[model samples]
Each structure stands twice: as structure tokens, then as C-alpha cells.
Target chain A: MAEAARPTFRPAHTGFTDTIATVVVWLIAIIVTGVFVWLLSDIIWHGIGQVSWRFLTEAPRNAGRAGGIGPIIVSTLLILAVCIAVAMPLGVGTAVLLAEFTSSDNLFGRLVRRSLDVLAGVPSIVFGLFGNAFFCVYLGMGFSILSGGLTLACMTLPILIRSTEEGFRAVPDEYRLGAAALGMSRTSSLIHLLLPAAAPGLLVGMVLGMGRSIAETAALIFTSGYVDRMPQSLHDSGRSLSIHIFDLSMNVAGGDANAYASALVLIVILLIVNSVASWTSDRWLHKRIIS
Target chain B: MSRSRSDIFLIWALRCCAAIAGAIVLLIGAFLVIESMPALQHVGITRFFTDASWHPSADASQGTFNLAPMLWGTLLAMSGSVLLATPLGIGSAVFCHYYAPSSIAKFYRRLIELLAGIPSVVYGFWGLVVLVPLIRQLQPPGPSLLAGIIILTIMILPTVALMADAALTNVPAQYLRGAAALGLSRWGTIRGVVFPAAKSGIITGVILQTGRAIGETMAILMVCGNVVQTPSRIFDPIRTLTANIALEMAYAGGDHRSALFVSGLILLALIVVLVSAAEVHSKGRIYG
Candidate 1:
């Protein structure tokens, strides 16, 4: 009866079909991997010789064809500083509210999450327009680093808030229960306990936000203006590294070497940030497991 | 007493932050709408949809503000990229999840993340220098709709592959075991069981990437040849709505600037619709 219950015979050609499918899957994987390797190697092979100490320290002499990216580097850092300073407080506060203060199904929390989802999905070009209209024109900031930084702050908030919320949520409930049972004040407990425990998540979110802001081109092009000179004040127009790369590659003839070097620098910065993020998270996880 | 007061203050601050974060989206929408009003009133809304070309002139009377061609171009590039990326992305995810050894899978995961981190402009530069020249060998115009599609496919592949990996990982192990107990082959189990379980997630990933492809500007602008027309062939030079705004906004003044804002408004609306669809399709995952 048991033998009869099973299929009397196996389906024919199943082996052939399975083998074919496996081969197709393997081919697809190889192709995808091959593309990635090709892109990275191509950039590195052409760009490596151009990256040098002088290239990193001097301003361009002949329309970005001759000099290093010193001023551009300064501008990028200043804009990034302004972006991080603004985004950090707002992002963390919102994340705390959603993860700690409100229930999952709370209406306000849901609304905020939905809005973030929409904002995250918004095209960066739309953000560029909004920044141009609201920050540069309406606010009378003109085309300056201040406006660019603010635009980036707005763009980075969605990702930062979402990730930080996830980070806060990951803290085990037992810790919260223990803190409350010990008569620790809500504020003190949160400051001393929850924040430290969630540091890895916070770091990851900040790194991701920084990466996105640093890579941004469309949003900064109009708000920051196209000035490659070192900006003395936040109000001064400045150019970011990504914008410089864009101008160099598209508008400037014979600017390919500098463009390649700039791209290589950008990729290296992103790589370091990414590794730091993963390394911190891994260390944190190991520490927790050990304790 | 002071500590409790500070706690109260902290709570209020957080609430304010949350409220502000939510309100920013509305503010952006409102601003875009207000900025676009001049074009809407001057050119009339129907002209945007009905006109045949996108020739924005400083003189409103002389300009034709037809956005249809660019709109079609945007959709075409988006759909074309999504079509090419979907199979490749899902296939790679399947390979990573089931076929590769654990060590190889981990390495592949890192590789995809690194791919995602590369900036759009860098990709554009690469596409312009390498991909365009390669394509031009076969076709006269190197920067065409095909180039845009290829760049976008690479850009959005990571998004789809990562999301699909998550979805596949989430599939209940019991289902796989049950399939094995029934003597189903590995391929049969994946096709009949894993795919069905992860269908919603995979669909959501594709939709999300579609939004990404639609919004992408710099790469498309760099490689798409920036011609304002509905492309009749894959090799035809085309302009996306995003490229249109970025290209003209710099010198555009008067009604022309307003017309560019109108394009931004449309992109915003399309994004909202896609995001809402994704949320609904994901079936309450937002709250979860």
C-alpha cells in the first residue's frame, strides 16, 4: 500500500530539465559577476596612475585639466559637515519616536513611515528641483553650500531615520524591562542604556547617509552652484567632487585623466566607509554574543 | 524634578522631529505645485499632454511645451531597463542563495553591496567613456536609448538582487523540507515552492527598481544623447523627463523654468504612485 501510494514511476526527462536549469542559473550568475569585475578593473586600470599626492593637494590650473582637487575636497567636506550636523539630530529623534515612544500600529508612526517610504522613492532630480526652489530661491540663500547641504539633509533623513529605527528596535525587550524595574529614569536609561547598545546601528545609518550625500550630483549641482574655488563661508557657492567629475567628463575636453582619478577617489572613500560599517556591526554582534 | 522636566522636554522634541519629518514630503509637493503654476496657467495643462515636442522658449507664445515625447521616453527607458534587469537580478539571487558555497555567497553579497555604493556620476562617466564607444561601433550615435537602458540595468540590478535575496531567505524552511520529503527534485522544489512563496517580495523588488530607473538622471543624461523625441528604435537618441529638467533648468527663465518644475511635479507624482503600490503590494510590511 505504501509503495503504491508513491508515484509508480518518476517523471521522464526531469534530470535533463534540472540540469539545463542549473546551467542557466550558473550562466546568469557568472555574467552578473563578470560585469562587476569588468567595471571595477576598467576604472582602476585607467585611474590609478593619475592618483597622486599632488593630484590630491592642488587646485586645478587649466579648467580642471592641470591641478589637484584641494578646494573641491574642502568644499565637499564642508557641505558634508553641514549635512551631517543637521540630519543627525532630526533623524535620531524621529527614529527614537517611532521605535521607542510609539506602538507599531500607532497612526502617527505609520504616517511617518509612509511618508519616509515615499520620500525615499522620490527621484533625486525632484529633490534637486525642490532644493533649487525652496532653499536657493525662496530662502534667499542663493546658490551656495548652505543650500546644497540643507538639500542633502532632507534627502538623507529618510534613510537615516529608517535605519536608526530598525537599530533601536533590535535592542532586546528584556533590557528595557530591566531598566524600568531598577527605577532608572526613562531619560537616563535611554541615554545610558539604549543609545549605547544601539551604537552599531546608528553608525551604520550615519555611514549610509554620508555615502548617499557624498555620491549625490543632481541635488547639489544647482544648489551648490558650479564654483570650484574654495568657499570661505557657508554662504559662498561651491562645487562638490561628484559635480566636478560630471563637469570634467562631459563638458571639459581632454579632462578624462582627472575624471578617472576623481572617480577612483570617490570609490575608495565609499569602500572604506562600507567596510567600517560592516566591521563595526560584526564587532558589536560578537561582543553581544560573548556577554 | 529637573530630570523629569528634561525627560518631558526630550519627548516633546522627538515628537516635533517626527512631525517635521512627515511634513517635509507635503512641503516638497506643495512647493513643486506652486512653482509649476505659472507654466500651467500660461501654457494650460492640456498643452503639456497634447503637444508633440518639448521646445521651451523664453517667449511663451513661440514655445511648444509638449511633454508627451519625454514622458514616453522616460517610461520606455524605465520599462526597458526593468525588463532586462529582472531576470538577471533574480537569477543571480537564486544562485547566491542556493547554488554557491557559503563562502562564495558571502563574497557575492559584499560585491553587490559595493556595486550599489558606486555613485551615479561615476557610472555615467564609465558609460560615457566605455559603453558608449562600444555601442557606437555598432550604431552611429553612441549615446542612445540603448545606452541609457544598459546603464540603468546595471544601476538597479543590485536593488533587485538584494531584495530578492532577502525574500528568498525568508521562505519557510518547512516548505523545502516538505518538497524534499515528497521526492521532488531540487529544481522542482525551487520552481514550484520557493518562487511561489517569494513571489510578492520579488514583485515588490521589481516595482521598487522601476521607480529607481525612472528617477535616474545623470547616467541617462550622460549616455542617452539627450534628444527630445519619442524613440522609435532602441538605438535612437532620447531624453527622459529627468534629463529634460536637468538639461534646461540651468538657462531656463520665465515660463521655461516653471515648465521644468512641472516636469518635477510629474516625476514626484509618479514616484508617489509607485511607492504606494509597493506598500500595498507588500501587504502591511510597513507596520511590521
Candidate 2:
């Protein structure tokens, strides 16, 4: 009512409104950050006491109620090894094919891209079902590490392919033209130049895949029988760290502490792997900038 | 140089490897259909979808493999979590993009990424230990759909927020400047300009979150007491398809196992639809 008399360019309470907006935004940000901090502190506080050299190296006793996760660690690593072995080559090859060999406008390329998207969204539990039906029963692997590893490999493939493809696509056309101008064969050029350039970015993908493998629980439950001991061979059933955490927390008496400890370890490993991934990629970018 | 023998062989091999990647999706679908065929044939597809009961091992005279309850539970939990998460995630993104100082925003974004990178099983553990207990003080029978929904909301928040932040950040600054030139308030500019510009992306993020929520197993399984009944209230126990498979597949055999495969098939179908919808939505935006 008094706006004309006041002769003000802005509303009277504009500053107040801005303050309110800032408060609300900060409140949300803090709450979100608070929840994460709480979760982390809870795990670290409870789990820190349990991490010991013996805990890392010794075998479980009395059905995993009162022992270490040594074998679980080994089995986890072994399954990861099997997974990366299969997924790395297949994923890198697929990425190379999509980025280099095919045009995105073509039907085959479109179909492959769509299929990759669909695969990326496929639930881990379905992978478990597939692993059970195809690898475990039909293939008669019988709830072994091989079945779990194979299933995880399949699950990791999409992540690997997508990231690697992005890495390849990020390589400018000038690099390829430069190589071709040198009279090098296409295969030789790709092998010597493009792949190495993409390797650092692909490492990020591999680390992410490794993180997924480490974190997986539902997919491995049925395929990898919840055995507590060290695996004798690829055919032998074994428990992974995630599965052990699940089984112990749910099944064993007084297993919550152990579960917490295992979870803490898993979280720490994930953080380290992810940081390593970013750090390596950052280092590569830094070098590129410097040069 | 002309293409060498090794070059041709390498190209052929790489193409085959690419085909293998595509074949994986087809293979999973084929295996699921094949494994589920027996159950589908026995139950009749219509009855399987319409039946209210899910007794896979009933007497030959009274076998009812209705999946309505699990389906309902999955939809309820997924939608509930997404509804709870969407506003919060988008709000966080808005704050990060338009409100916060750069240093604060950077730290906040890092925290969100850390949250995203935490494993689902640990979330399950936290739900079982911290969240459930906290809920118990307010409500009895803490392991309920509400618990599952809350845990899912937390799990998916980082993803949705990150996607939304990217979308919001990508909104051309010219629009913001134009809105300011028109004397629009900050929230007004965001509502009228930023939101419309980023509509497709936010929907894609929401759809992606839905896919993850529906497929979520470990945390939901731990928090949502696995009762194969229709949940009437937020505090009621319910089962999701993912949880059902994870809970029963261990000891299941015969038709029960095949029936589990059918559940997996349904989940696969849901994911395929959601993912393709998201893909189409993103593609449409890319051109327009």
C-alpha cells in the first residue's frame, strides 16, 4: 500500500527471504551429511576394536561365531580375480567394438547400446537366479566359487563396458588421424596408442567393478554356498565377506559384532579402492595438463 | 599398409567379443524364460498373475501361485521410497547448484558420493542395528514396509541427488540471467526456468532410482520382515520379489525353485521396462 511513497526498488523483506532460503538449504545439506557421518562413526567405533592381525590372518572356528575372516578374505579375492579375468578382456573388447567398429546410428549399434542399458539395470537377484539356473544346476557347478565368480563377472560387465566406452569416446579424433598418418595398421595403432591412453580411465571402471564385487551379497548367496572354510579349488563352495556378514548377522548367536567388523572392513576397502581410482585418473589428467 | 592377417583376426575377435556382450542380455532372458516355463505352464500365466495366494507347494488340487501381494509390496515400497526421496534429492541438488558456496557444495557433493559408494549390505546392517532400533522406540514391529521404505530412500538419495545436480548444473546460465532480468525471484526462476529445462533428466533420475528400489534385495530383506502377505499399513510386514527370491532360493527346489525363477522373470521385465523408458526419455531430450 505504501510502496509508491517508500520509493524502494525491491520488496521490504527480500533480505529476510534470502536468509530463510539459505537456512533451509543449509539445514537439508547438514542433515544429509549428518546421517552419513553417523553411519560411518557407528561402524568405525564398534568395528575398530575388532580389527587385528589375527583377525585378518586366522581361520574361523566354531561355525564362524568366534574366529577370523581370513578365508573369507581369500575367497573374496579369488572370486574377484576370476571375475576381473573374465570381465576385463570381454568388457574392454566390447567397449572397443562399440566405440571404434560401429556407428551409433546403425541398427546393430543401437540394439547393442539398448541391450547394454537394459543389462545395466538388471537386478542383482535376477543374476543370482540366472546363476542358479544356468551355472549352478544346468552347468552342475554345484554352488561353487566358479558359479559365483561367473555370475559376478556378468554383473560387472556392463559397468566395465560403459566406462571403457566413455574412455575411448573421450579420445579425440586427432589421435586416431595422427596414428593413421603414420602409416600404422589399425590394430597396431589401437593396441599401442588408444588402449594405453584409455587404460587410466578403464582403471576407474575396473576399480568400480571391484567395489561392486566386494559389496555384492544377494547374488552370491545362492550361487556361493555359505561355507566358512578356505576354498580348496574353483569347484569348492566358499563364503565371501559380504555373505559372511549376512549369514553371521542373521544366523549366528553373538554374530553382530563380527558382522559390524566385517562391514567396517568392507566400507574401508570400498573407500580405498574408490579413492585410488579417482587418484589414478586425477594423476593422469594432471600429467596430460602438464605436458 | 594394407590390413595384415593379425589385424583382420583381431577385428573379427573384438566384434565377436562385442556380440558376446550383447548375447549376455539375451542369454539371461532365455535362461529365465526356460527355467520359468514349467511353473508358468503349470500355473497358467493369467492365474499366476491374478491369484491372491502364493503357495507353490499346495496339494495338486489347490496350488495357488498368485503373485499379487509381492507385486503390490514391491510397488508400494518402491513408490513410497521414490516419493520420499525425490523432493529431498531435488532440493539438495537445488541447494548445491543455486544456493551453496562453492567450497561447501564441493564437500557436500563428496559426502553424497561416499554415501552412494557404501555397499547395500552395510545399509542392511545399519538398518538392522540403528534404524530398526530407532523405529522401534516410535513403533512396534520395526521391521516393516516403513522401515524398508526409509532405508531405500536413504540408499537411493545419493544417486537421485547426483543425477539431479548434474541436470540442474547443466541448465544454461542464459536462462537464469533472463529470468533475473525479468525480476523473477530465485525460487521463481528455478521453478519456471530450471525445472522445465531439467524435467526429462529429473524423470530419468527418478526412474533409475525406481529401478534400483524395486530390485533392492539385501537391505530390504533385512529390514522388511519377509511376510508373504499384502501389507495394509506402513507398519505391516511385506515381501518384495527380490526379497522373496533371496529368502527362499536357498532351500527351494522342484516347482518352488521354478516359481522363484518366475518371480525373477517378473523383476527382469520390470527393470527392462523402466530402463528402456528412461533411455527413450533421455534420447528424446538429446534431440529436442
Candidate 3:
């Protein structure tokens, strides 16, 4: 210790601690980043060449056979449709009731708002079980697209409701007062002026909600059983890209190669959807800021 | 027409539905109780929480339940991840907001956002492929809590960082400028002014990350080795409540199935505490 304090005996260590710290940070960051990239690369690098025209169009077959994400793609779109239809209305309606219609002091208003927040926090796995218990056993819908979609609705409603509420709340009060002074009815004013004014933010909410519903796998599992065939109706069982990825990762034997490709595709889709969400939101909000 | 009775009634009705969100939480509580009653009747509540064994006959003719080990595992895994992530997450957030060049900070922010967009399964597989083999080289030959914790730390980094960054950003810029004018060093100004202002926000982020770590399923399921024992060491594999529900529900029958619902109930209770904490903090105006 005395030798080190002499400064000459110190091991050429001006920033030795900093060098070690930087090395450690880079190691941690690189490994984390590399693992993320490897997960995608392992899949896409192997699967992309196979992701030809036929692969996209054809159905997935038994292990190692030819198949595409056809049914999975349709299921994704279908779930998105059903989820948006159910969740958006419930969420937007709740938001409307909160922001414009009801005073928060009322018991029901407080209840709705809090429950939505709680609902948002409920884990996906629990939602899956709830879906299974209520919808599968009680409703007799069976493991179908509709049931999964509806369950997803329950899952994403919080996001939609809150965002929509924010959108409505964001509408300037002055605009409404000015409309009223110009002799517009409240209903007409809300529909023609307020809703239109809040439209972009509301749309952003819907887009983000759809993205969430699309990415979900766990909740839909119990309610939407794995089916290889295309959905005949809302009652028919189906698989989604997310569930497909889950199924492959779990059910496959040694051939983890396929799972990698699927992971890449899923990551790509997620990026696309999220970017679209942000873009739409920025554009919408930008217009609002200017207006 | 002037506002009328039906219009008011309809508005009230909608408000009633709006409040249905709160009722939904109650309904979920009730639903779990109802769903688990048969199982609870079969096995006393104490047995469910105390007993260590979880073997149910394939036929489910025999009752089987125990959650203590899983609960221990859940707590252990969450604590591991939170302790590791909080410092690094908050530190990175501080460095980016206060130290890094604006472009570099923005880049890091974007990187964190993209990380958030990656699905849990991808994270799991990344662990399965990379972490599992890496762990095997160590003393352990299985998934283990360390792997799960490390993976979870990364998973929650974006979430904690974003929230904390927002909190720090919300600190009045004038505070930092005032501190600079007082001749304090840059680090001292941040330590003295910015941190105190953002402490509540950072705490809020830590709490939320805890919630995420506790509730997470898929990644933990894959990386936790799904062992049903209380952990003796960080490398010791263990099953968590979320993993317990996931692993059993697919094949669980009778009481076993209902017990999984009971697990859900417990998780719901945990989440309520989290939500209420956030609500309390929000009401207290704790730097939201």
C-alpha cells in the first residue's frame, strides 16, 4: 500500500478502474445485445431462404414438411379484428364515460376507472385461466378464434380505455365552449367537433391496443387451442403467430432451427407494428399541436 | 333540445359501465374464490400454503397441493432481478439524462424502447440457447434462478429506465441551472438537485419492475428449470407461482386445476398491493 502511494510503483493505472468498468459494461451490453440478435439471426438466417413465395401461401405441415405462416397470418389478422372490435368499444366507451360523461366522484365512475387499472395489471397467465374458466367452460364457445379474441379483448382493454380517456381529455375545453356559444347541441358538438378533434389520439390508442392483442400468446392459449386448420368460423380453433412460435419452441424436438426463423419473423412484425403505432401517434399528435 | 331525462339516464348508465372496471377486479377475486372453493374444501387453506409436496394422481382421484416452495422461489427470483437491475437501470438513466450527449442519450432511449418490443418467448429462447449452456459450464447443470434473474433484469430494464428517466426529466430544469449558478460541480448538482426531485419516480419505477418480475411467466418458466423447491442458492432451480400455474394448468385435473386458480388469486392480491401503492403515490403527488 505504501509502494502504491509512492505513485512510481503503481501498475500503470491511470484509468485502470475505469478501463475495467468500461470493459465490464461493454461485455454486459454486447452479450445482452448479441443474445437478442442471435435469437433473431439463428431463426431468420436459416428460415428466410425457406420463407419463399410458397412458404407464405401454403399451410404448415407435420414436422419438417413444407408450410408457411398462412393460417397463422390469417389468425393474427382475425384476432386483431375481433380484439379491436370488442376491446375498442368497451375501452373507448369506458373512456368516454369517464372523461366526458361521468363525474369521477360517483361510485361507478371510480369503480370503472380503478378496475380498468387493476385489469391492466392482471398477468396474462391469470387472464388465460379466467378465460378458460368463464368462456370455455361456461359459455360453450370451445377453444375457438372468437373466444381467444374476446379474451384478448379483456387483456388489452385497459390500454385502450386509458389512452382513449386521455385523448378525450386532451380536447381543449375552449373548443367545446365556443361550439356551445355558436348554438351547437352538446351531442352534435361532441360527435362533430370533439370526437373528430380527438380522433388521432383515439386512433393511436387503437393501433397500440391492436399491437398488444396481436403479440399476446399466453391468455389465448387456454381459450384458443392449437388447431392446424384454417378457421371456419369464430367458433373454430386456430393458431396465431405468437402461439405458433410458442408451440414450435415447446413441441419441436431437436429442430430448434425452425423456431429461430419464426422468432425473427415475429420480431420483425413487432417492430413494424410498434413503429407504425409511434408514427401514427406522432402524426396525429403533431396535427393536434399545430391545430 | 335541452338536456333531458333519458340523456341523463344514459350518461349515468355509461358511467356505471365505466366503473365496471373496478367491479371487474372484485369479480376476479370472487371468481377465483368460487373456482377454488371445491379445491379448498378438499385441501385446507393451510395445507395449500404450507405443505411442500405437489403430486396429484394422473387420475386426479387423490388431492394434491402446496405453494410454499413456489412462493419462496418467486420471491427469490424477483429479489435477485430487482437488486441487480435497479442500480444499473437508474444509473444508466442518470448518465443518459444528465451526462451523455443528447444524441447518444436519445439513441440509448430508442434502444431501450426496441428492447421493450421484443417478446418474452424470444427472451426465453435466447436464454434456452445461450444461457442454459453457459450455466451448465458453471457448478449448476440446470436453468437455475441466476439465469432467470439475469434475463428478467434485462427484460425490465427498459421499463424501469423509461419511467425513471421520465421522472428525472420532469424535475424542474431551473433546479439544475440554479445549482450550477451556485458553483456546484456537475455531479454535485445532479446529486443534490436532480436526484432528490426524482427519488419518488425512481422508487415508483423500482416498484413497477418488481411487479413485472413477479408476474412474468414464459421466460421464467423456460429459464427457471421449473424446480419445485425453495432455493438454497442462486443457482438452485425453483418454480414460481406464475410458472406453477402455467406448468400445471395444461395437465392438472380436479383440485390441482382449481389450486392453480388459487395461485392466480394470490398473484391478483399481490398485484392489487402494487396498484394501490402506485395509486397512493400518485395521490400523494410523488413526482409522477
Q: Report the number of the highest-DockQ candidate.
A: 1
User: Residues A1-291, candidate 2, lDDT per residue (tens digit)?
Assistant: 000111112322345566676677778788888888998999999999998989888898877777899999989998899899999999999889888888878677677777888888899999999988889989999999999999999999988888788778768788899999998888988999999888876898899899899999888988887997899998989899998888877778888888888999899999998888767767877777676
lDDT of each residue in B7-67, candidate 3, tens digit only = 5665765665565545666766777888988677777688877665877543333655778
- Model 2 segments more than 4 A misplaced: A1-21, A285-291, B50-52, B58-62, B180-183, B284-288
**Candidate 2: Cα lDDT at B15:** 82
The 10 consecutive residues of candidate 3 chain B with the worst lDDT sum are B56-65
Report the C-alpha lDDT of model 3 over A228-261, residue by residue, as the tens digit: 6778788888888777776676666653655666
All models, DockQ values?
Answer: 0.55, 0.51, 0.33
Clashing pairs in 1: none
lDDT of 1 by residue, B1-288 (tens): 235776888889999999999888999999999999999989999999887677888766789999988998899999999999999899988878777766777788889878988999999999999999999999888899999999999999987898888788778877877776777776787799889999999989998889999999998999999988888999999999999998888999988999999999999999999988989999757323
Native contacts recovered, each model: 0.69, 0.60, 0.30
Identify the leading candidate in terms of TM-score. Answer: 1
- Error (Å) of candidate 3 at residue A200 is 1.7
- Candidate 1 C-alpha lDDT tens digits along A126-228: 9999999999999999999999999999999998897788789889998899988887877888899999888788888899999999999999988998999
Sorting all predicted structures by TM-score, with the top scorer first, yields: 1, 2, 3
Please list the residue runs of candidate 1 whose C-alpha ends up more than 4 Å from where it truly belongs after superposition.
A1-14, A286-291, B1-3, B286-288
